[model samples]
Target chain A: MSAREEVLARLRAARDVGGSTVPDVPRDYHRTGVHAPGSAAAVERLTETLTDYRATVHRVGDLDGVPAAIAAVLAGSSSVVAPPGLPGEWLGEVTATVRRDDPPLSVADLDRLDAVVTGAAVAIADTGTFVLDALAPDQGRRAISLVPDHHVCVIRAADVVSSVPEALARLAPDGPLTFVSGPSATSDIELDRVEGVHGPRRLDVVLIVPPRA
Target chain B: MTTDLGMPTVASDPHGHLRGTEPFPVAAHRALADTQLRQNLGHATRTIRAKRAAVVGEVDDWEELRRAGECVKADVMARLPELLEQLEASVTARGGVVHWARDAEEANRIVVGLVRETGSDEVVKVKSMATQETGLNEALGAAGIAALETDLAELIVQLSDDKPSHFLVPAIHRNRSEIRDIFLREMPDVDPDLTDEPRRLAMAARAHLRRKFLSARVGISGVNFAVADTGTISVVESEGNGRMCLTLPDTLITVMGVEKVVPTWSDLEVFLQLLPRSSTGERMNPYTSSWSGVTPGDGPQTFHLVLLDNGRSNVLASPDGRQALHCIRCSACLNVCPVYERTGGHAYGSIYPGPIGAVLSPQLTGIDGPDDVNASLPYASSLCGACFDACPVRIDIPHLLVQQRAAAVEAHGRPTAQDLAMRAAAAAMASPGRFSLTERVVKLGRLLSRSGRIRSVPGPGAAAWFGARDMPEPPAETFREWWGRRERS
Candidate 1:
């Protein structure tokens, strides 16, 4: 018999046997009863986790104040790359040269750009991870968020989840979800860490609080 | 490309050239003696282990996640053929092509053919064990295609022409100065005067690979997990090199082991949480890129998934041994293994070295081989259970190791002088009358010893143990002797 047939037969045989018990994967995350503790509480936990990884976290009270917040952080930068789907209202305060995430931008040009502000598809509260799908409107090409010196990912409280299982349920299988826990870092040397080896050097998470209903 | 016949075969005993009778002790002595390698391994592993612990601890459902990860893997293994067919259909529907390789030779041929068809003489590679096990780079090089390793540590090893020493951190054996020297010597157009500083070395590598990233027409990668439900493959890495390789090329060829398959996208949650923390000691990797087939004008225009089965099916056959297939290649078992800590990975003979290699290598290749290296792999471990405990999949490595040892002994035929001694021991153990007779004889010999311990004994049995360690003196009397004396009194 062919090796392929042998493997298929073995897989079938192993499956037929009831020797090993199946392990429990987390399908019922809600049964855990871990409440959100409110959006402010969730943001606080996120800030703590982000700071633990040494990333800078900032908060904006309202959407109108977002542009000013962005300007304050990127004050000296003349050019800012906005994700194609980025809300223009957030960039209203910035009077400097703004670069929209265009397809032609090379890795070198993206490196030269001042900053990028893109909305995340989901913010994992448990892991402090932000998922960016390429299809997401404001999040330009993945290279834009990855190559730039500074990345300001915008996360809304409602998108935040308490566990990885919860976050996985919200994501589409075919969609591209670039899970970013923190800025790029590596300890390839004699156990000495060097950040920004290939990705963003500075990660500035802009937590946009939902407006009071 | 035509050198398939020349590739080392199992019976040739390739790694035996580097091994000795004192395999573990010799390798461990050298590794432990190297203060630099020891310090580097210690610190690197501790940091990653700690990060994994912290991130893994954050979620109360982590145990559940681990269980889920195991179950999903088990499920896939059970329904592998059906799921693979489903996956093939899905991939084909999305304009992606699939190829099946029965073994390393077949896998290499398919990859070489694919790269040749792309008409590219060079291809960028993301770190993948499937490629390594097949010796794909060497095959590609022989085929006249330059396979460039994009992962930082892999790049260092590639530049130095060295084999990987660790699973996750391939260059764990090398220090910063070694890396700098390699960069200075091997990198084309690299500055002659480069410092051993981490930042400088990274920048130099970055500058070197940026060109490859932009110009390469074909990209080769290994997937951490393939979501059978969506026909999606996930590549997680700290460096954006993977992202570049996955996105920049027109044609992307992913070589994945059949074991990497998962039932659904939801299964990714269990592994995404398990892998990052376990391998890199991070809450999440810097980049977790998942692409399905080909994207229109965005990522690769053409995608090929090479489902590799070099020796995985053989491993999946044994009841106890099949659990070894569940390994995620996290290198957690290696880090915590006392044996691996001393010998490093090179001693294992196969591309996969360490505790996982001990059971895996022999099974992958049929056990009916004359190679001393394949025979020696099962004995490499101390059966301390440390590896099994450290394994993310919880493979009972010790159980498999013992089973492999039995298989090895059986393969070698009935009994050598050592086997006869063990058989004699079994006989003595089975009959109390013979056991007492042997005990009395041993006790009578103890009269000559000044101390309770015997410094040495004269026999073939003594040679194996006394070769490395001092033999302890025999006790003045056996527990049976004492019990007899008590009853008489």
Candidate 2:
């Protein structure tokens, strides 16, 4: 028999011999947080967690405040690239030559740029994490967010959720997704956490709060 | 009703890392004798333990979450065959090919062939326990392809030609100074002025592997969780190397144990919370990358998923011992195990070294007899119940350990002297007359007691058993005798 057939047959036998007792997994664990998504408390928790993870956080009052926040985060970066679908107005104040991924940038193009700016699909306040879906035009492809040393991710105040399950519920498993909590870090050496290895060493999370939905 | 369910599925991959090299006692004795290793193990485990406690303590519903995680894995085991079928179809529907391997050799062959098809002479690797278990790098090396390990700890072990010593930190046996020496001697372009500082050492590694990650055509990795419902496979990692390999390579090959497949996408909710807090003592890992299959103008358009059995079927056959299959490779059990902390991971002699490895390795490759190296694993644990308590999935590791011990005794082929003694004791205890007579005869041992303790006894394993501890002297009078005297008074 082929490997697939043999393995399946063995699993079936074990099921038959062991008795069929499908377990009922309880979902009593907190699926949503006490603080509502995008609430003041939720935003406060997000800032605390992101700061603890060593990501620089800047909060702006509204859509108009996003340009200055993005500009300040990318101050050290000479060249910045934004997804084609990313609003042109978000980078209006960015002094760095803001390039658009119109034709879709290559690895070489992403390598030369100092930083990349994009919008997040959602952000979790409890874990200080954000999700980037390739299908989200604002999020662009996975590589664009990965290659550059500095990643300036713009999260709207309303996107923040309280817990992991709450954040996961808003996501679809249909395409490539990246869940980033902090800048690259490792605990390999003597089990001590040292940040800045491999991925973007400098992660500037810009939380835009105003223009309330 | 069933004629053939595949009886001898217990044999593991010949090239796999399941079997230990030597007996546990002997290897552990050698490891304990090394003071430097004991210090290394103590510091690393203790550091991780404290961090884990702090993170896990903060969660208000931690126990509830662990329970849900445990039950979810149990559900996956009950629905194993169906989940795997769904996963294969989903991955295929999304333009990814799937291959199945029964053992280690087959897995190695299939992966090598896939890499050869890509026609790349080299591949960059993310740190994966499955690859370590299958010894993939050696197979690739023999086939004239280089598989460079990108994780800092894995790279150190690779450069030194040493086996991994821990699940989370493979080079825990080496301090920063030793790491510096290894890098200076082995790495080709390392700076001469390198110090033992971890930040500097990590920067050095960054410079070394950057060219490889950017230029490599093939990337090899292991799956953390594969969502059968969506054909999505996720890799959770801390360092950016995982992202570099998963992102930069043109073709990607993922080797996943069949037990890793979960039925639905939502199942991730329980495990994601359970893993990081338990494994690395962090609220979240630095990055978690998941992709369904191929995407145009994106990372790794060509993808292949290899489903590995390698004696997992053998583990699944046992009624009670099968819970070993629920492990998520978090290594929390290892950090809390007293035996592991003292003897260090090297003593276990398997890629999986710790309380989990002790129960898991034996079940993966059935204990043939006393001489079967994996047989000693069932006895490696002190059965303090720490492992089960620390397990994120609540595997009941101590219960499983006893079950494996019973299985080992049954599979011994011939009874040992200890087995005969146990049977005799059981028989004596079953009958009232035999029990009374045995109790009466056992009190005669007071004649040999010096200070109400039996320092030595003569039997098959008595000397070894008495080496570490002394037996208390039997009471002079039986309980029934004392009861009769009291009644007469």
Residue-by-residue lDDT tens digits, candidate 1, B355-397: 8888877777656643345667888887999887666666788
Tens digits of per-residue lDDT for model 2 on A37-139?
Answer: 9898899999998999999999888888888889888878899988878999999998999878878877888889999998999888878899999888898
Candidate topping DockQ: 2
lDDT of 2 at B381: 84
Off by over 4 Å in 1: A1-38, A102-114, A210-213, B1-35, B191-193, B369-371, B444-452, B469-471
Give all TM-scores, in the order shown: 0.91, 0.96
**In candidate 2, what are the lDDT values of residues B341-370, reduced to their tens digit?**
998888887788888888888887778787
Runs of candidate 2 exceeding 4 Å displacement? A211-213, B1-8, B444-455, B475-484
TM-score of only chain B in every candidate structure: 0.91, 0.95
**Candidate 2 pairs with clashing backbones:** A61-A210, B13-B104
Residue-wise lDDT of candidate 1 within A115-210, one digit each (tens)?
888888887766678888888788766667766667888777777776667777778856566888777767666444577666676788887776
Candidate 2's DockQ: 0.71
